[model samples]
Target: MSERVIGGHVAGLITVGAADALWAGLTVGSAVPSASAVFTGSPTLARGGYVLLGRRVVAAVKASGGAWSVPEMEVRRAAAELGAVGMDCRDLVRIGPFGSAPAPHPVHDEGTLLRWRERIARELQKPGGPERAPRDGGHRLSHLAGVDWRQILVERPRMGMAGSWWLPRTVVRLLDTAEHTETQWLHTARTRRIDNAVIEPPPHDGQAQAADAWRTTSQNLPTAPLRPYSGELQGLVYSVVSRKPGISRKVARWACAVCGTAPAAVLDHCHEHGYVRAPVCQSCNTQERPDHLYSNDIRVAGHYTRLFDTDAAVWLRHWHRCPGCRARATLPLPHLAAWTAHVACRTQRPTHREARSSRGRKPCGALRVSWTGGHHAPHTCVLTVVVDFCPSGEHRVLAHVPYREAAEQFRTWLAETVPAVAAVAGPDRIDDLPTHFRPVIADTSSEGQALF
Candidate 1:
């Protein structure tokens, strides 16, 4: 009852009988048994009635507890052979490749074959069972292909035509033949490259003028001299052009001012010392504050630009501060535009380092704190500028400063100081602060400056 493989010994008799019957059908010349006997492979023969004859074989397998995993199409075909008139019922039978030999030993009588036929019919009526279907057009070549041979035998078991038929030397010959066919197929595909079929070429563009220019140059150029020249010409210029500069202007300028960024209308000086700042694109400036606290590098500023583009920034205004830092982040056009233009105009000269003229160098001025405060952790103020007494000593704070200690503090002050300049402004507006201002050092406001 359980769908497990019973021992060969347990189902050995049933396995053998099904196989023998299937073989008899394939080997036309072999002296075959009655149809019921062919299907059930009952050794004992009986006359009189079909019922009594077929019952013995069924009782043998059922008593042995052999099970069938496959359906009953071939078994029914065997049944149909027995059901036909006379015993010349070979027309009702189909032949397939049973491995090797024909049925071994004594054939069953007519009556047993008839009864086995009726029992196989009864087995076919079961619902939700492996329903048999015609395979490979019911041709003799089907068995040579070994198509569904296991299903015909072990799966149905009643067919008695499984292993014994296919394992034959003759069937092995057929298998070798099939393998040869497959080899030929693979060889054709590899040698011929049939998969890569030729395709038509695309149409050429009429507006392509480069070819005409090349033709004209070929006509104008003199032919190679008759003799080879040994002398070299002086001042020969070899040219190479690149749309993308080898070194990014922003990176060059920021790292060392000698290698400057692109040019722009207005320049953002290092307000603390009035050092001429590197040209930064308007795009870089608008996305970030001059603070340099959250993100200082131009590359980082570019990344934020992509993260909050014009439309995205307009949408981002609904959520003012960065959820991560809670700083007063805004997207203004004037700063962005100025930064874009600045980077575009500036260019770095590789030889500018060698051609230095230190004519009008000025002394480093007194410390001047320019910017301070806005949600900077551990300490407040988004940015601050101080002057150092020694080149590397702890810097002294400057007098006037703009500080933003918190989100509310910065936004409130920005409304008054910078106002909302523009959603998108031009190159001139990067460091263009409002006219009205005060020095934090001069005023004794609410709380004294937070200096460490």
Candidate 2:
């Protein structure tokens, strides 16, 4: 009943199932609390039931992910890091283009981790689990799009639709087809451009499993026949990725930067670095990504601007509105404001190869904050910021206005840029500081600088 993914015949492999893929991939459009779960794809879960859940919880705690290294955590990471840059981890770390979160197994607390295991076990334990799809409205459900119910039995499960039948993408989308969110969940829209080579990779068929568990594996995968693209949209996508200094085909997706809902045919290159910011639809992409068409970028979108919350960090919900109200329309992405602003800031950053210049640059990007330990003298705590961020080895000192103003500015930008900054739960040892939080200021405590 171990959730270790390894068994008698599968010592070096993990037999992936549809549940693993779905739990690993079904991205919720809204971000308030993006639902996430880690799928072990162990064949034991079929009959493991509550026992599987209990075991996984203990194992998760033992992993001590950030602090201690456990085999469970190290295996996948080693498996991923060892197999050419992006192959082995594709199925396991299905985030961003070919990466996300560095390691995908650390996003759980004990309670959530237990529930994640329990959910999958019970879903599989259900009688005729594969056939019994989740309900939509009242009985007799007829048609369901985005799902090939027939193939759930025949085909192997892959990412995206590899979900529990109760909450497969088809079921979730079908149920929320009327969903229109005018709200915020700030996870950025990332690309998962899986090519033919990745579709039926090794994880899809690593080893055999119990017939019953294996049959239920792809229950969430509702797949249909493949359809080749030959439309204007395809041409638009090709044109966007084809242009030099435009979006590289690796991570460029057809999602817009303004309202993430549309097909982004226009590739918006950063005004400064000549790097792609976001691929916007005809309705989005503010920068002259294209000429003939009129585009509404996120900063100036009249109606779209009103959809954001007070912080302007995320979108607002359109669940409740008066008659004839279009509040339910999902215009820009859940993280449009932050993403646009982040991209806007990145525009100031010159690529590593480019020489630095200060024609018209915001001070925030160059600002580096250094703080003294306040534990000894809380009242005498001092925070200092320096203009030290430069690709070329050059540091500039600056006299900041007020301490509070500088701190807030740096904190906000740090959250968007570093992202992992807020998660710094004080390093146990000074040597273990998070990369960005590492002490960079010169050791000026004893007056003159000393040679190392």
Candidate 3:
């Protein structure tokens, strides 16, 4: 067979064997050779001067157990004489249902697809072309190329500027020679260095700015002053300091009276001004005055009830009288004096003088003495005894316990004494203290004292 070319270049190669020649000749195109005509010269040339005859023959042979078509008969035929049953002459010569048009091929595997993609990318590497994305539509290849070019530029050459504040030589060169006046777009489009370019100054310092902020705050508040601000308030303060007319002065006297307690560990003045506006010890201005005996009794009971884990009602009920009893016992002019004297006696009892007296036989002739009836009897006589040392006819004697039992019995005696008033007053007595015993002093001036 001679060399065949179409459109000025070799299109396909040809060979002659029984099956190949048959297949080639049976092609329907007008340019094709007939099967019988080609096979007619085959047997004669089998051993003749055929240089490279083996290769040509091998190419001409069909593969084993394969099938082909015979166009002359228009039917499928077996490759009987060929070394193999069929040969894919698809590359060499086109012969199929749609003659010169090739059959569709199978889809490429991943590796082949990737290889084709890389080839496409390399071919597209030159500037102007339609841009193509990766398998998943990522511009990965373009990004990689950009990054590689950036790395090369960064590592390869250093461009310097002329003046102190001049742009870098690379930037100046790129700007001077750029195709468009929009140099920023050109820089972003062409070079990867745009990402690293400096655009603006550094951010402001928030902390330092905050530190320089203007601020305002109030100070030196004048708390409670010695005198109130307005005239009305001043008058009010004066009024409170001074007692009103026709009021009893017992409260005033009691308020001003300095408690005779020692160490001065009690309030002696009222705190009417300053941050702490309450009664305080005059010395320290911090402690409260020791309260009245009656007030202190209530306070102590209350304190014990609150702080000592005792039932307050039970504790209070033990010592406190109903109002009527308290009034009846402690009120009335005579009762007042008696109560005062009783308290005085209790206060002075520790220092009271005791007078000795004889027990058994009184004086007769000489003093008759008896020592457990060993007979010198002391004489007995009726004599007037001086009692609580009242002048003349008002003498009264009272019995007292021996010193050994006094302190121990005092609590019982006190308990007994307290209930006596309540029992005497009975249940239906009036609540307020009797008017006569309620001390009344002249309220002539407000120079001192208040708080009955």
Candidate 4:
């Protein structure tokens, strides 16, 4: 093997085996070869060397059956490799497929698909590349490089910028600098620091500069005017402030500005004006949200859904809880108050619905919970309970549990409250009842076809 260089006097790229040998030698009281001498004999720190090194390291770590953290010397060596690698390797991801989609290669196991792809995509598709994506309150995750970087960050520098940040610095720095200056390229790349080159990577949706994110560009930024920013956390303040616009995560962490509770759980903003008002807790978030105003208006509903985009598991705060029946509701988005009224309506005993039986006296309560869904999907069954003679008149969904057991519990609760609703008796009643309660589903042959 001979010396290799990428214009820098230092050699680039190192094998995981070499790294292991170096670390093992350092741990014990043995002497290893010079770092430059070792790396120079290996492959050039171009795209091939970079990719192979990462793959070998990940494989070696996996083979060792320990955690995915590379050693300190290895991390430092990797940084030196990035510094020495030529700027021409533009498509290492294209070559390595490190962050490719739809079941492609995985570098960190967890981050390769979504997190790495997102960060790498953010870098690759900047000014000279494709259009930048609009931010939807998603913050940039720092130190997404290796393991959970936060877990072992203390030993980082005797090491390097944890291999997570240092290694990807290859992608972030090398890829962009091929087209731009080293300093200019560092402006927006995802890594927090590269050797002495420290920078603040802005949140995905933030307009703040990478150099100084908290320093507002204009005298009059569209920042929330309610309060000033304050926090012990340094790097994330820009993002937290951007999400709520008015307050930092620290302010939101301990007190709801509206109610002044112990702490706030939600980042609340105004839908109409698009101004971030304050951070609020669950109860306050529900009370302040004018969901009723959005119930009927299609435009407003669309805006609200887009703005909030509540995941079903997050349990969007709602004001529809009952006393004895416990009308706690959890539903997916497209959440109109009218659509979710059944969550509240299901708790109250529905007025006895007149019915006709095959033989004699009619059984009451026409199984008011109407739904059409997959054969065995527990949560897929969106139950809409239409209570009889209830003043609301319109139908609404009370709740849809992710687990069958939860749905069954809900049905049991309904059964204990309104016996006739759960036990279908009349022939006409069978059509409107949920599949779990109905004696027979008219169509059971189809696997996924809707059974209404």
**Number of backbone-clashing residue pairs for each candidate, in the order shown:** 39, 17, 20, 6
Best by lDDT: 4
Of candidates 4 and 3, the better by TM-score? 4
Best by TM-score: 4
By TM-score, rank the candidates, best first.
4, 2, 1, 3
lDDT of 3 by residue, 1-452 (tens): 21121121111212233324443433323111122322223222212111011101111111122211112111112112212212221212100011122222333211011111222234234354224333243323322100111111111111251111111222212211111112222223223224534221123333222111101000111111121111121112223433445322212111111211111111121112101111211211111111122211111111221211223222122212224223222221111212222332233322222235444432111101111110011132111111332323343422222222232242234345444433443333443422222232211121112221
Model 4 gets an lDDT of 0.29
Q: lDDT tens string, model 4, 1-452?
A: 21222121112223444544443333232111112212212222211111122111211111122211122333444344433443222211111111222233334311222223344334333453222322322333322222122221111121222111122223432222221221121222223334334332234331112113222111112212123323222212222355555453344334444345224444453221122344444334433333221122111222233223332112222111111011222112223222333343435433433345445533123223344342234466454433332343534333443334344444454455444433431222223222342121222121111111
lDDT of 2 by residue, 212-299 (tens): 2222222212322112212223212222445556343322233344454433334433221122333443323222111110121112
Model 2 earns a TM-score of: 0.20
- lDDT of model 2 at position 197: 26
Misplaced by over 4 Å in model 4 are 1-14, 17-70, 73-268, 277-339, 348-452
The alpha-carbon lDDT assigned to residue 56 of candidate 1 equals 16
Off by over 4 Å in 3: 1-218, 227-343, 346-451
C-alpha RMSD of each candidate structure in angstroms: 37.9, 24.5, 54.9, 22.1
Q: Model 4: how far is 223 from its true place, Å?
A: 24
Residue 349, candidate 4: alpha-carbon lDDT: 37
Which residue window of length 10 is worst by lDDT in model 4?
317-326
At residue 328, give the lDDT of candidate 2. 14
Clashing residue pairs found in predicted model 4? 145-164, 254-263, 342-396, 342-398, 343-397, 343-398
